[model samples]
Target: MADKIRVLLAEDEPSLAFIIKESLETRDFLVSIYGDGEEALAGYRKDSPQILILDVMMPKKDGFTLAKEIRLSDRNTPIIFLTAKSQTSDVVEGFQHGGNDYLKKPFSMEELIVRVHALLNRLELPVNHKEGIAIGQYVFNYTRQSLKFNEEEEQLTHREAEVLLHLYKSRNEVVDKSVLLKELWGDDDFFSGRSLDVFITKLRKKLTKDDKVLIVNSRGYGYKLLC
Candidate 1:
């Protein structure tokens, strides 16, 4: 059997942390859950995991701070920030501090698993890989978090980047809202649902210049990224 993907999850919420840990473990992932960023960082130093799931607000140290430290030690290990903060500045700060992905609160386990697998897949790719995906006339540089339309480059927020990348990867396919919520937010509650709607609106406006790119709403079903 292949080695299980090791994950270090740091969240102050006990119930939520338990759910996330159990969900990941059920998928054969070796998970170490911590309520404090300091403790999680300690465990990280002792034995680095394949990925780190961090909550933005925590005691001792925050996710952003820990991420910076982790980056200093290990640049390649993937880091996913789990937070309730949906502000554009907060999202930008997360990516600036080296967050590989960001998930808002009220996400579902299913969505988390999908993102985990996606990050792992990207990490497993060879270093020389440089294929930039084309979304309409824009070239999305997933590694650099830059979207280029014609000669203009737009820097995407962490959450925006994750959402866009996932959509691009699932091109011409229907991406269920529940799946996206579960993967990105960890819970599919009302607030997160609203948050997802806001992001979808923002992304739609940003990609409006390209008539070929469409984020079709499927009413009760979910969303479809049609090219």
Candidate 2:
């Protein structure tokens, strides 16, 4: 049997944290729980879990502080913020402190699972140069910043590549516009919002050859890449 993946979960709400821990354990994850960020950080230093699920607002230290402390020594471990903060600034701060992903409160278990797997995939894959990610008929080369479909190849700008990679990773699921803006642009200003629209249009045109692959606008909500 393979070893279970270790998870360190820190949240002040006992009931919610318990539910999350049990759910993850049932999925064969080895979960260690802490009620405060201080304890969580200590556990992280001692046990060194493969991933962290931290509440942004916790007693003592706080999730953002813990993340920064962890990153000071080890930047490889994936951190996911389980926060109630939906503000663009808060989300951006989460990323700046070394969070790979975040889930706002009142979230579904299914959503948590999807985000976890997405982060895990990036961690498990070899760094520096991955072969590519296949999206229907298109092959996206991350290192080369190019998308290829049959005989055609299109080069992508840095921002375009970043946006496309996020969409591709969360393919078939709607990713909130605010989430993308925070992760990529660091804020949800008017200019960045317009830029995202432009990038989406460019991506849609590039994948025109593949009828099964498309970036779908979720009508005032977000976008979903259907592949």
Candidate 3:
């Protein structure tokens, strides 16, 4: 049999955590469960699981902080944030802090399972190759999801890499706002649009090493990546 897919689950509520742990275990996953962010961080360091399901509210570090920490070292692992906060800003914050997906409180096991499988499928790109796309002063490796400038390397989330790659493909042209959103996020709705803005901001920051490289916004239409 294939090795069981490892999963790290950080949830503070004992009952809810138990439910999540047992559910994933039944699905042939080896789940390392932790009750707080700090413990979860340790579990992550030790297990290096393929998937991480983090509760937004936790003792010590919280899911957003934990995700940020993990992104610092491991950008490829998929993170699904569990939270009761439904505001658009909260959603943006989760994405800003490196969450790949967000699940609201009281979600169904079936939906969670589908999300887990979906992320695994979506983010299974090959990595660590040396080939890179020359983008001004930065070398962006889509496979590795990293942008390197001189000696420093900025790790990008899978979504960010995807967006950057897409923009690069159509550099110097205005990529329609709706088109980019629909292609990347599978939705061009207001919430997803907001998330896209956050990603664009992050990419702009990383590309700031070379001021000539810019993602210029075309009001009422789209964006153009000028390199």
Instruction: Return model 3's CA RMSD, one decimal.
Output: 4.0
Tens-digit lDDT string for candidate 3 (10-129): 999999988888998899988888999999999999898999999999999899999999988777788999999989889878877877788889899887888788777755544533
Measured with C-alpha atoms, the lDDT of residue 177 in candidate 1 is 87
lDDT per residue as tens, model 2, 57-136: 99998999999988776766778898888786787577668776778889888778777776676555445336778889
Worst 10 residues of 2 by lDDT: 121-130
Q: What C-alpha lDDT values do all the predictions have?
A: 0.81, 0.82, 0.86
| lDDT tens digits by residue: candidate 1, 73-112 | 5666788899899886797678778786778888888988
Cα error, residue 106 of model 1, in Å, equals 0.5
The model with the greatest lDDT is 3
The lDDT, on a scale of 0 to 1, for candidate 2 is 0.82
**Which wins on TM-score, candidate 2 or candidate 3?**
3
The root-mean-square deviation over C-alpha atoms between each candidate and the true structure, in angstroms, is: 6.0, 8.5, 4.0
Cα-lDDT of candidate 3: 0.86
TM-score of each: 0.59, 0.61, 0.72
Which stretches of candidate 2 lie above 4 Å from their native place?
A: 127-227
The 10-residue segment with the lowest total lDDT in model 1: 122-131
